[model samples]
Target: MITVVGTGTGAPLSPDAGAALAGAGLVVGGRRHLAAATTMPDTAERVVLGPLAPALDAIEQYLEKPADQGRVVVLASGDPGFFGIVRALAERFGADRLAVHPGVSSVATAFARLGLTWDDAVVVSAHGRALRTAVNVCRAHPKVAVLTGPGSGPAELGAALRSSGRVLVVASALGAGADSGTGSGASTGTGTGTAPDSGSASQSGERVERVTPAEAAARDWGPAVSVVLCLDESRVLSPVRTIAGPPPGPAQWALDEGEFTHRDSMITKFEVRALALARLGPRLGEHVWDIGAGSGSVAVECARLGAAVTAVEKTLDGVERVRANAAAHGVDVTAVHGAAPTVLSDLPDPDAVFIGGGGRELPAIVTACARRARRSVVVAMAALDRVPAVRDALVAAGLDCDGVLLQSSRLAPLPGDVTRLAATNPVFLLWGVRPPARDEGVAQ
Candidate 1:
């Protein structure tokens, strides 16, 4: 039988897990993972898995030789089922061929130490890649915990967040050096509080505290073992009971033109913006580009609705305003300082695109939007002359184009104890969607 064990750094072997590893004759794992299997009989062969490709090749070679030669033990960190080596091994050898064991995950211990609930937390890893992906999530999600690695460790994440005017909490070495070590090999990403600190973030911090990687390894963290980051630390409202999850209240999107802090007459009218946003349909798991985002009301609103949003605002003033608005609403929106259609090249392909400030560039911007957007594009225009040209651009891109003339009036109290129709302004909304390929259409 093949047994998998989690060798949590600072904690003792769990009863069941110890039993499994004790019976193994051959053990393979990362250098750190091998610690738990070290106490096995001297006759057992110990192998270190690394550089992944070579390690996997060696395992396959051994499995091909014989089964009864010896029982094999594979060691993993944290919950092996999660982004762990178990994925690689299971894929090659098949699930039925293995008997698994588990431990607590980093996310759980981190949150537990902070006395926070992780059900709503967005957990991501920046172990080997650039920290951009995790940074983006922190920009967007209120409660996020990022698993850090060598390059993208605590300090890097902290610096990125500090520059963005966001506050964060970092925990390191959660299962190591702590009396309550991390649980990594578990099947689930949760942990039960067995000691006094169990289950409550309040008490958990006492048993397993949070620290930066530097602090944990610095001889100062006492017994802390891992990092748990809170993106918006300044806003953690002390009697912080509720999740404050998914924004504090209702959405007040599509605000009037005058609502934004813009100087040079660059605002999308309320009516037109409403139509543009409807066609765009922003939400979580998708990306939207608010090109020429003036005050960033649309981009901010989309982010609050859970979409990963990027706002390309050319002017420094507009970028600042967008940042302020995004923070005020408690949503993460990236207000990039650049011109778009030109600047759009580096970003991930957008699911939706909105052009509110692009003038004669509307057509080209629309074309670019069509190419980059997987679903739809929406453009706003005040000049009647630009409408047809923009519409034609959409049609030429092979999209079903549609346009709307938006004229809205707010009821105002008149001086003579009466109500009046306060006509705001006239604007146009142009939306388009690409027709599915004829040959590749879904078969009925």
Candidate 2:
């Protein structure tokens, strides 16, 4: 049978945990982990982990031994399940063949030290090829704790967040490496995993508390926490988990302007937006750029269809409002916090582009959209004089161009006794499509 042992807090071996090492005929673990089990009666034959491949081979060799011949104990740090080697071991051997004795996981200890409730936090590892998933989760959630390895450690994460104006608290090396005011931004005492309650260290003493991302980055932080401070709070993804999703309901959207909190003269009218969404035809596996995404109605609708979208607008209030709208719709649209044509550089390329507002930059933005868009570009113009220029820009970029003037009449009360048709201003929707050369020639 395979017995898993957790070296309690990585300091002293508990009486019960120490006893696990006494009669074992085989012990498997990292060199340092097994070495921490010094209290064993020295009757155990040790198997050291070198390069990963060799370690797996050693574990397989130990499994070949006859049952009841001798006991085997595998040493793991913290809980063996939280980003540990236990999963691989279980996959290799059936669950019935092993018994696990866990140590306090680093995450539990980290939370305990912080004295913060992490029931709503997601635990992820940045030890792989990319930190993007962890970063994305951080952007989507209120709280997250990332386990670090080489390359994509705290510094790397901090550098990536520097773009989105995010703040990070890098707590490195917990337990032993927590000393010297390094990773955690404070020097911690050698005591075990529980919090000291003061929330911070005074002078030379160590404890748990909040520290600035800059302060955390300046030190040689230990294996610790990467606390992400959002560009804004709404970016947080709720930390609740469920076995399944809720039941579906009618997709009642394309709401009127009165539903949201928007600035005067800043909302997209539903009629115009419906046409834009119909033309955009958002779907999964596609990316769209919604320029001048006021109220973010188009972005939200497209994202609701599962297409990844990015909204670009000028005013900070407009940008934040767009983000709030997108979040309310439960769609993933990166609400860019700056003006388009300038802020569009950092974004990923798009498959489709939509322009809602502009001045002289309108034609240039349209041209850029045409060149960048793999399929199509859509522009909504408010002025009649600007249409010729926008249409010319699209056709100049070699796209098939079309335009429609949309004028809607709202029903409003003309007198206390009767209602009349109140016609609103006209809007020009000029669309451009880059059809395949074969199809383009077919029209001839």
lDDT, candidate 2, at 129: 51
| Backbone clashes, each candidate | 27, 13
Model 1 over residues 208-289: C-alpha lDDT tens digits?
Answer: 4333333323222222324446556564433434663344434567776665665665667667777777899886556788
Q: What 10-residue stretch in candidate 1 is worst by lDDT?
A: 186-195
Model 1 sits at a Cα RMSD from the real structure of: 8.9
| Model 2 weakest lDDT span, ten residues long | 177-186
Residue-by-residue lDDT tens digits, candidate 2, 1-444:
777876534344455555667767788886656655655447667878655566667767876878754677788767777677778777877777777777777666666665654555567677765676565544443456766666666556655444443444343334443221122333544322233422233234433333333433444434333222222234333445442221122275567877665777676788888887777766544678999887888877776665657788887888888878876766557788776687777775677888997787888788878878877889998899999999998899888999899999998986678999988778999888888767545656
Q: Distance from true position, residue 69, model 1, in Å? A: 3.4
The list of candidate 2 runs beyond 4 A from truth reads 8-17, 41-43, 48-51, 163-167, 177-209, 217-219, 222-256, 263-290, 297-311, 315-317, 320-341, 347-444
Superposition error at 378 for model 1 (Å): 3.6
Per-residue error (Å), model 2, residue 217: 4.2
The global C-alpha lDDT for each of the candidates, from Candidate 1 onward, is: 0.68, 0.65
* CA lDDT for candidate 1: 0.68
RMSD to the hidden true structure, all candidates: 8.9, 9.2
